[model samples]
Target chain A: MNESGHNGLVERVAHELKRSIKIDPSFDESVMAEVRRHGKPAMWVRVIAWWRRPQQLSLSPLSMAASAAVLILAVAVSPVRFGNPDGVEPIAEDPAARVIRFELDAPRASSVTLSGDFNDWDLEATPMTRTSSGEWVTTVKLVPGRYEYTFVVDGDKWVPDPAAPPSLFDDFGGTSSTITVPEV
Target chain B: MVESDGQLVRSVLAGDVDRYAILVERYRDRLGRYAYRMLGNLEDSEEVLQDTFVRAFKSLKNCQDPELFGRWVFKILVNRARTAGSIRGRRDRLFVTDEIAILNASDMKQSEYGWREEIERALSELPADQREAFILKYVEELRYDEMAEVTGVGVSALKMRVNRACRRLRELLEGVYRE
Candidate 1:
């Protein structure tokens, strides 16, 4: 057969097949029910639900306010300095800051470095120290916030923190680990 | 306004679990037809469809682009249908008599059009890969690129499969067309 005739035949077959097939109405309902049975709320929804949920407090508002007032009065009455009373020097210590220790096991690796949102993914910014037990470890002070990071092994392979939450695939086709440092 | 697939996907991911029904409803018919054609049976097709939707829901977050949700879900359905078809094929081989009885019953229901029966029989006789390629290209009217994405096969190979399928189908249905 000529190409056009062949094309016409194919189109006719497709149309006939298409016209003959009809999905049962209940198919969608059945599928939806099965999905509902197995489907959980998306991650974001669960997080929002957690946020909107009412939290119980041990102290009533009136009592809590009264306690706060009393504490303020006591603090005012006392001569204790919350910080440098001279006001000449800035406070060097942040009570909300926390020291987070990052550890990775890389016995076969010659070197390991930590890189993440904290260090702007600068691979060389935080080099890890190898312990005698062959574990690479590093400590860094971080303020409370969410961060995505990865480890650079031997200044080449970028590996996500296996212990952290699921890593996000970056735009550069690389994986990065995520962490949320809670505010104290 | 009807929300795009991408919008619906975002809504579903934002915690509106019910919005997923919109997606299910949207693609059900098209995917059902594809699965039916691929599996050559309604029961296996529906099973694959249900499984595909559930799997898609669980992996929605990992869908790189929600805009192409149809293609992504179709890919999953295609894979599930292939697996289901394989299992069914094995069972049919073991229970050849039962398989023939079931097919004959099905053919009776579809016997209204002898041409339809001939086409369906010819389609089922094609190799699975060629049948898939032919259905996706000619029946589903998918572009070559879309077929490649869904089948994970290169465009040239898909074209060759479709060509081979057409040749074989013409040969099978020659008597019907001649009459």
Candidate 2:
């Protein structure tokens, strides 16, 4: 075919290919269902639940951070207000909740957040504070259970915990590090 | 004024989970078409589309520029389509045109149906990368930079692929299309 004919064929094919596709009636509903399944509870509600649970705070120093001392607090002894949004007074702390510390050495990151199934994978639910030594740290009082989580670096990059075991399943292009807290 | 994609993304991120439906609805058909053309079947395309949406939702916080959500999701869809295509493999792809033609036989005139079949056949004949480059450049009408973002290929290489695809497609379709 000549140049004009070739161009015409390309344009014709483009037009044919651009025809609108037929989507199933339930497409939006189906997507929303999946999204809802991953929806998270409010931070305050989770924090409150954490306070009410039995917690035995253990300060086991991880091998990755030899100088990074773990902060252990007796839940029953300390008055804790865990960024409570409702301003509800802290209830009497239960002595059984286990405080697990998560740390990442990201000296350059301006911010880091923890996301996991335990917190319904809510990224904003757990922000990690930066230490003077440049390790990002946050402690969550999780009850005895298996949890899959990744650290959000600089609010946009997801990094799995190097010190923890990787979960068997990687989801949505992010790998999660799994930690199993045994029954206290 | 209509809400920007960024606005919708913000609402969805700020606990308005329902706002996500807008984003899904807005991009579904376009992305579905791309997936269908790339994967050569409705089942595979829809599955890829669904996976792309769910993946985007799960990682929405990682979308640095919410205003470009459409592009971001399209990138995910491209990757998923590539994976699905590779896994399914093109070993049985000779019949893909027949499968699609039969499925839509009732919807078009006989001549139009035959022509469409020829086009799909020609498209499926191109290597996957060339086919992808062709479709994104022509059918989707994306600029070279945008195509680069979606496919992660440099502009010069993509231009080469598109040229080769057009030449190959013309050769494949000439016999049937020429009077």
Candidate 3:
């Protein structure tokens, strides 16, 4: 009787909650219809967006403090982060004289590839082999300069670093991280 | 009826606006629920969800990960809800979009305001972090990892907030939800 009572309790709670709100089945269609009202996105949109960012950008100490606070909020409030032992190995301290590492917490991806301006945006510059725990890791030698980079997972999807340095605002209006590789 | 999120993103990037429909369809329910939970108003949730997609589409190129579509949209929705809530607060009436009457109905049932008011007041009493954690974990049904992606916080803190929120909620809803 106790077991039956517990089951009944769960059912009643579920029923009451389900009765509270209603959502349309075709919500996606409506939203898509709304989006199409503006037309298709431009090909090379990211590249174009990148070129249009405030070209005269500069970083200052004050900006760093503000960005750090915002960063802390973004970090603490967000449910995802970089460097999980059970997630990504967080690149074992770079050994090369001028080393840069790219990591993504993609446990399901078979093979990850590194691509960005550092490789002249070459898709084949460095193909990241997966590790036992499933994160993809890759490193590239670099000269002291800033670079834009993204991870190509299993030959599909572009993922940015959720834990990198400040990214400039795209003219299209979202942020991506930037890496200012320092001189060794 | 569908393509992988990556395909849709590629199509969007390649100028196929229609592909966006799939993503909208894919995430519409989740996004709506998230908005509704956060704002507690269907109308405001709809508005926020609509605006989020609009902004996302306008800036699709910035969506670095199509597979992480849910997370990306979630981040956008979080920002929009915060903005909407703040703006509504200035009016001192919450600018409720079609939910106050229904949820707030219970007040008449009791000599006091009602169950709806109690729920809202109790939720409002929570610190933002704890409330967000509870809503996402319990109401949104997000796995801890997915919640992490959306909030960018450590799992331990999230666990603490959810636990505290649950304890507080049980205390607040003693007689109402208990029955």
Identify the leading candidate in terms of lDDT: 2
Give the better candidate number (1 or 3) by TM-score. 1
Cα deviation at A148, candidate 2, in Å, is 19
lDDT by candidate, in order shown:
0.74, 0.79, 0.63
Summing lDDT over every window of 10 consecutive residues in candidate 1 chain B, give the lowest-scoring window.
Answer: B93-102
Q: What is candidate 1's lDDT per residue for A59-166, written digit by digit as tens?
A: 989999999999999988976667756645553555677999999998999999887645534456689999999999999888898876777787556677778875
Question: Which 10 consecutive residues of model 2 chain A have the lowest summed lDDT?
Answer: A64-73
DockQ of 1: 0.16
Write the residue-wise lDDT of candidate 2 on B1-179 in tens digits.
77888877766765667888999999999999999999888888888899899988877765767899998899878867876776566345564864556767898799888888888889988888899999999999999988876765557878999999999989988977763
Off by over 4 Å in 3: A1-34, A46-184, B93-121
State the DockQ of every prediction: 0.16, 0.24, 0.13
lDDT of 3: 0.63
Off by over 4 Å in 2: A41-184, B98-104
Q: What TM-score does the A-chain of candidate 2 achieve?
A: 0.51
**Candidate 1: deviation at residue A47, Å?**
5.0
Docking quality class, candidate 3: incorrect
lDDT of 1 at A99: 97
lDDT of 2 by residue, A70-177 (tens): 233344454655676565655554356699999999999998988775554555778999999999999998878788788877654668899999865544333468
Candidate achieving higher TM-score, 2 or 3: 2
